[model samples]
Target: MNLRMKIATGAIALVSAGLMTFLGTWEGNGQNVVYADNLARGLPTVCKGVTKHTSPVPVVVGEYWSDARCAEVEKLVVQKGQLTLADCLTNQQISQNTFDALSSHAHNVGTANTCASRAVGLINAGRIADGCRALAWAPDGKPVWAYVTDAQGRKVFVPGLYNRRRAEAEMCLK
Candidate 1:
């Protein structure tokens, strides 16, 4: 197959896998749950029988999980994350990869912000490239601020968030 065909095939497979994972149909291991970058980065979580936190802090507490608990939390988060995207993106037709990537970002940032974001505006206007580029910015269409405190307790830019935005932008392009 040609390179284009190969890429198309791979994207399809990825989308299918992502959908299954999001829907809780695909059972992932504890490692998968623990290693999800967004999860570890202090994104909002939905643990069963546990009240969800409104404003989550950006730190991982490793001592707070059993294998069963981790899996349950992962599934709940994934399902809720997809729902957030669906709610915000009502009536819009987007590719699976775009949906997955944007849902990941929206999951971290919040659905309200994602719904009102410049990226969504651009997307709704059918300016796909511009919309993808907008993913690198904050939801308000400005540069994302650095909130991570440094050694001296001063806020500093987080390279990880920058990298994550870049990855999301790349995925939107795909």
Candidate 2:
């Protein structure tokens, strides 16, 4: 092949490789299906419809957790047939624009971390709609919260689950 053709071919290969890596583990479906199944129960699934709406989830950050014995509910969220935390939070009741911004923020914080500040910022900036929204609350019984970890995994929980709200969002932040 000529130099131009070789360069074009190399570019295509590089793009393909990058795309595959970005997709993470998948079977043409960006899903770590095996990984999901192999984990213990309550490890959180990426699937949305299957997520229990009223399910009580364990909240933990660093080490403190709500009901130290309970586990976090695990659910899978898929975007474009590829499962991702970004897809789950976005696709679930939340709007598309919000989803995009949240997705970007999640990426910036590493999908798993998906910092609570992003959600708080959205609400504070008035980008998010007014109403009840799900967020991990501090264990002390306040409104603000950051990251929630459990014996199973770490994730944000819907609001109603708390009696008066777990703890304010501010308690968990560093």
Candidate 3:
């Protein structure tokens, strides 16, 4: 592989079916409904977790869309997210599964934060397995980032986030 081969020019599937399906399964593929995202302080979300920040167009709480429209917007959101993820990643070739897993991770954590995370740094240092492990665990082998701040500012572990991170880490390792 060329040394400069990045996701844009490499064989990394930017919007592969596998990624779409994985996102749909985890993000909830509602046909045509917009609702508040409890995980995000009740941000308005629609069509497989498309939020105002991620959507190309404006997202309203009660906005309605057709099934095709939902898919289209979701695709656009995913492409934008994957492209941002590619930009954040090092200019080295990676497996489609790893790229997809990282893209999903980035989608959840925001690209800027994900780019600055220990996982990305480990991957850039060529410790791929360690990078994957860092997605869910700290260097001391304790789980991390699986919590939500409650209204009282208490850290509450979200089982769903834990499961999702574990799955993403497994996919990255593969």
Indicate which candidate wins on lDDT. 3
* Steric overlap count per candidate: 0, 20, 0
lDDT of 3: 0.81
* Cα-based RMSD of candidate 1: 9.0
Off by over 4 Å in 1: 1-16, 19-51, 54-63, 138-155
Tell me the spans in candidate 2 whose CA falls farther than 4 Å from its real position: 1-82, 86-91, 115-174
- Score candidate 2 by lDDT: 0.31
Arranged by TM-score with the best first, the candidates are: 3, 1, 2
RMSD score of candidate 2 (Å):
16.0
| Candidate 3 local lDDT, residue 130 | 89
Q: Of the pair 1 and 2, which is ahead by TM-score?
A: 1
TM-scores for candidates 1 onward, in order: 0.59, 0.22, 0.92
Q: Candidate 2: minimum summed lDDT over ten consecutive residues — where? A: 165-174
Better of 1 and 3 by lDDT: 3
Best by TM-score: 3
lDDT tens per residue, model 2, 74-171: 21222321224333332233333333333323432334545345453444444344212323333253444333455557665434323212221211
Cα-based lDDT at residue 147, candidate 1: 45
Relative to the true structure, how large is the alpha-carbon lDDT of every model?
0.54, 0.31, 0.81
lDDT of 3 at 115: 86
